[model samples]
Target: MVFADGTERPCGGLLVPVTLHQRTGLAAQLGAALAAPTPLTAEGLATPKMPGETSVRGLFVAGDATGQMPSVANVIASGSTTASAIVGRLTGAT
Candidate 1:
């Protein structure tokens, strides 16, 4: 797994397994994998975000990070959509 800083960590009780790149593409994939799943709470998974923000300016969020369905196809679609959105937003078009 990978730490937030992109450092590799041990997995499966092994001193080392796969590289961090082999894991999720998002930040702190290791934290997500190790984190215990729980029901969403107002103070937990449902964090607040700034108003009028579609995505952080010039920084787009896609895939599972954006709460979309998880799958290879979904991820690919998310990437394409994010790229299109970014381009459109930068170009000042809807």
Candidate 2:
């Protein structure tokens, strides 16, 4: 259905019909729609984080936004870390 370049194959009669009962595992199950929360900030996307914060304050990023690891567990960790950073910044503890 997809190529390494990230383009769709246009079906080309290659698509298969699968039912919920027949499917299994992560790929078999329905996946949540995911996308970057926002475009690159003024700092743009250099690495792990935005400039310091995005153009919007109180907003932070984790997971895919950093363009690093893309595993579910890694994203969860990133979110936890980002949340802590935000809390600290808000409470003047950072």
Report the number of the highest-TM-score candidate: 2
Cα error, candidate 1, residue 24 (Å): 11
Q: Which stretches of model 2 miss by more than 4 angstroms? A: 1-44, 47-57
Q: Which stretches of candidate 1 lie over 4 Å from their true place?
A: 1-55
> Model 1 misses residue 70 by how many Å?
0.9
Per-residue lDDT of 71 in model 1: 63
Number of the top-ranking candidate, with lDDT as the measure: 2
- lDDT of each candidate versus the true structure: 0.44, 0.47
Task: Compose the digit string of candidate 1's lDDT tens values, residues 23-79.
Answer: 343433322222123332111111123211232344455554544334689768767
Candidate 1: what lDDT?
A: 0.44
Candidate 2: tens digits of C-alpha lDDT, residues 7-90: 976665754432112122231122322223332221112222332243344555565454444468977887788777887888
